[model samples]
Target: MFDTLIDQFWSLTLSGIALGFIYVLVSLGYTMVYGVLRMINFANSEIFMFGTFATIIISRDFLGNVDGSKTLPLPKLLLTISLCLIGSMIVSGLVAVFVELVAYRRLRARGTNKLATLISAIGISIVLSEFMRMITHSRPTLNPRILEKKSLFEIAGANFRIDTVLTIVFAAVLFFVLDRFVKFSRLGRAIRAVSMNEDASKLMGIDLNRVISATFLIGGMMSGAAAFFYTLTYENTKFNVGFTLGLAAFTAAVIGGIGNIRGAFFGGLSLGLVEVYASAVLGTQWKSVTVFVILVLVLVVKPSGIFGEAVQQTRA
Candidate 1:
């Protein structure tokens, strides 16, 4: 197993990079919410799941059938994908905002216990998942392949697919844009200020509710993008699909240091690489087990995570 893995190392590495890009996008939702509210929005998985559905609906309704056999022209493919991306992002963002309003806003307004907020998030998560299941009649829906995978290039005898290359490049560009926005934009400063000290930010005249809503919106948009890419790769969607992916993404966020934006990205990439290498060495069944084991070890060694400062400091 070890020798075989070594022989196909580059192939596994590239595959891991592509998977890591998705994880990073989803993990951002987890990290961003934690950064602002000091709590996990468990419903975020559902947010991602909804984006997948949104893509399907928008494609079938507006763009017509996406035939996998015949390659779409470049302009048409780009336009179709752009529409899917917009539809998913908007739907997910709106859903996230709704979750905050319905499940979290009242609790926060009343200054309820953190446990209450956590429980509420979990409840919302369940509701959203079941709602989606009911809407799809518990059936697995297939994504229309908008971009057919063709060999983009070869690296170390591995033929990289065009879709894989595009996914990675698009994710990298978005990450850079988001990083810059968070670091330099006016609203970004407000978000940071609120994250660091809510009371201080409020004293400085920042509207807490507005900043929190914007955080959720941004996070949801990222998850929506992940959904589109994931469907593009896997070409399928199921009700429970978000659970495992969400768990992995949450683990990535924790491993990178929950609440740290850059840490989420770093941790996601690291986790992806680790999972792929481990699967190659141990076997496919052990992939998830290896990821959790690494998470435990990382937590044991550094509970605050790779980029996590003092965990206590992040809490309100």
Candidate 2:
């Protein structure tokens, strides 16, 4: 019975864990930015899409070509990864910042209803995605690094690879560092205070603009890293790549409770695992449906999210 249970359950659980890591990395941005702004930047997804493509370009330049790309020296690989990560982070963050400056900042000053902001965000999202689609022609581009990594092990009878391990370990480290940054650091304190009461925090001499920008930067950086990890995993990308992934990560943000950092982490990880399991049980075709179902169920029970601020408290 135990052996049978292992055969039946371990596969989904392990795979879920791996997928969950990716989700967390992606979702962290949404959670962080939302915590401060209380505004959803729909274009955030496009920023992520940009990061993935940037990494692909960098990888191509570093390697010779796609199929026949030369492997970088280990030092170069490290440099490539670091430089690409930083470059993508800065690019995505700047885009996020620009969106705020152009689209949402003035409206926020006027105390616009979140609905208007959401619509504007969606508009920006569409424009950015369409522009990208036009630029890249909606074609899928390959990144062999993610797919080409050799499988490294069969842990507990489950196949695991270097990519899988790296994804998980990197995500864990990022989350830990972010948790510390948010909880123990001065910037984190400022961010939390603003989230609790933006105007009141301002009276306390907090620069709302700076705090908000910082939030975008952190989120953008996280999204950038996610771009790399995601590219590494799937090995190919295309225009609008960020849409579905962004929605899924946002769903994780919701399921875990928006404005709750830990909630995003748990929500993302949970969603990833659920997707993995769904692929095994219901077939991959129905997996997206399965995700929406989970979202609906979570909303019905815990509208505020698992670790999110209680609705009553936030309203008060």
Per lDDT, the best of the predicted structures is 1
Off by over 4 Å in 2: 1-8, 62-71, 146-148, 309-316
Candidate whose TM-score is highest: 1
> Tens digits of per-residue lDDT for model 2 on 218-244?
888888888888887787888778987
Q: TM per model?
A: 0.95, 0.90
Q: What is candidate 1's lDDT per residue for 198-271, written digit by digit as tens?
A: 99999999999999999999999999999888888898899888898888898899898988888888889988
Query: In order, what is each prediction's RMSD in angstroms?
Result: 2.2, 3.3
Q: How accurate locally, in lDDT, is each candidate? A: 0.87, 0.78
lDDT of 1 at 256: 86
